[model samples]
Target chain A: MAEVVTNLSRKEQVIRMAAELFKEKGYSAASMRDLAQKLGIEAASLYSHIKSKEEILRTLCFDMAAEFRTSLSEVEKQNVSASEKLRLGIIGHVKVMAKDLTASAVFMNEHRHLSQPWLRDFLLLRINYINRFKTIIEQGVSTGDFKKDIDTKLAVMTLFSSLNWMPGWFNPDSTIEPEKLGQQLADMLINGLKQNA
Target chain B: MAEVVTNLSRKEQVIRMAAELFKEKGYSAASMRDLAQKLGIEAASLYSHIKSKEEILRTLCFDMAAEFRTSLSEVEKQNVSASEKLRLGIIGHVKVMAKDLTASAVFMNEHRHLSQPWLRDFLLLRINYINRFKTIIEQGVSTGDFKKDIDTKLAVMTLFSSLNWMPGWFNPDSTIEPEKLGQQLADMLINGLKQNA
Candidate 1:
């Protein structure tokens, strides 16, 4: 599990361990028994904490999505220039990824295993989140903060892809603060979108 | 499969379907028998072309890695400004991804299933590939074609993260040609890195 890096949580041991297991074995292949064995808890005790594997995955996906939504809304509320708003947005997203590296990786990679109504809701949550970004870019362009000619959809995707790949590489104990890392990342992407003086 | 998106191949039917199945079921969970059933062929017939499931994955990862290496070497041979070279390099990569969407998706997602030696070799190939992009950005910086103050490592990673997420969202029947799409992506990224004229 990524160089024996599984002990990523203390109080939330079950959720983190299941995230690691789900990440390792894929959601469908991993059993409650396996998770229980890893946690040294009985399957019945595990059942008390969580209903099913899918429920855990659902919680991670929606909770992370909600965090992102909340972060974006917080950034949007600031009375900053459109460019600064975008920079802060990038930082906010990176902070979310840095806060829970394993869970973020699980959300990014294993969320596909989520079932019907949950999957639909997850997709809706995701699209609405992305749409808010588009609005930010649109406002940035209109205010001359960004290049008027930039493709809003591609730019937003580029911003996300740049920001979302963080968990694949970020170290859990790296000295670089998440906010500073976010600042550098924001500098890179926002500079690309920024209009010339 | 991704919303009934599995019919993504023709001549290389076995490999493509395997990629899809591997993507859906994860390489560990998917079996030779399942692959044979999906292919409408006998198990022996499946073995005649591919020795094992891991062997199929090895071919995908190494072959795609080789393609990327070849593309980088080809771009390096061209005598152009570093920024233009970078743009062409990006186009080369996007064309590779766009050429075989399903296989590329599988390569990105399922390469982790590769065993030890293959995994080590894959990592080396990837780092070397990434290093080439870093050198290009470095040269772009040295030539005063890019911002002198940029973090080269972060900038290269940003370029890759921006490019590597294509399979997640790019439509198989996208109206945008890979080259043109590559052009826009290159413009967005390079402008971010470009020195003020």
Candidate 2:
């Protein structure tokens, strides 16, 4: 058990370093040697831990997807109102992006570099993830919590677009904390910026 | 006059082809030779019309920026309610993206590839563009057309995020006409997606 924990931590370290490099140089331009130089490790040693750069990218994309899926699943199981569920889901998505800015950047930007069957699979996973939001919005409309006229697909797209673009602009040192920002976004999306009578 | 017209038409043809190539192969991997080959002209002849590959990128970015600025200027002159101004601003934005899908895609994706002083200028222009939205939303809040409790900056960011992302997913062939889709987005943003009593 101890040995396995140690090995996993070492792999995690490699992933961390790789994410920064990938984010800075882009996945296509970044090389294993560059990653090793950044890590102060021999290139061969880097290879021993991770099979290839593609593996690292695949891991990052799938891991981020898995984290989202797990979070959404938990949100799904909660016996909360549809609006609450949507809010929690948005918060969960923002928190994930906030937790690892570099990894999230790579996950969002480098998915285009993913090859073959994995590319197709990753896309389907993304669709499924988006559908979760759509389902929540649909439920809200059905329950009369959300505006019935709302285009569910467009609403989901808007929500995801707003949430996904965070890594591009979010500053970790900003005065607005991530959780608070998440709540603010949820409030705006649900209640809008216009005050009602 | 005829000769000048022909020359300008040829230049427009090159820009159009360049936009397509830039969108497909990306700014970095795309080359002058490839662009020339696509146009069935000698690479040197391509130089007679355009200075360099960077010139193409610069032209596309700045041209798109100019279009947005022009549209916003028109929107700014309208004597409408603050909410109406924002709606018009968004519609103008979507219309630009819808009209030139390829150029807009290149403008969004390849802005990072812009070199040196132009890159810095482009970044400033983007900030200026975003500030325009911020200003409109602020006006809405000041006039009580928007909720005072809303965070102006986040609201602007959310609006841009939603509008800017249209290029990534918008299918020109979709049955949803761009004008109607723009109206729908405006409605959602101005009035929260929640059902009101």
Report clash pairs, candidate 2.
none
Question: What's the distance in Å from true for residue A120, model 1?
Answer: 1.3
Clash numbers, per candidate = 0, 0
- DockQ each candidate and list the results: 0.52, 0.46
- The positional error of residue A58 in candidate 2, measured at the CA in angstroms, is 1.2
> Per-chain TM-score of chain B, candidate 1?
0.89
Candidate 2 residue-wise lDDT, B72-183, digit = tens: 9899999998888989998988888898989998998778877789999999999998998888888877887877787888888888888888888888899988888899
Instruction: Write out the backbone clash pairs for model 1.
Output: none
List ranges where model 2 is wrong by over 4 Å.
A1-10, A31-37, A40-48, A193-197, B1-11, B29-49, B193-197
Residue B180 accuracy (lDDT) in model 2:
88
lDDT of 1 at B94: 95
Pick the lDDT winner: 2
Give all candidate RMSDs, comma-separated: 6.1, 3.1
Worst 10 residues of 1 chain A by lDDT: A2-11
In order of appearance, the predictions have TM-scores of 0.89, 0.89
Model 1 C-alpha lDDT per residue in residues B17-120, reported as the tens digit of each score: 78888867667677888888998987678866667878888877787888888988999999999999999999999999888777787788888878898899
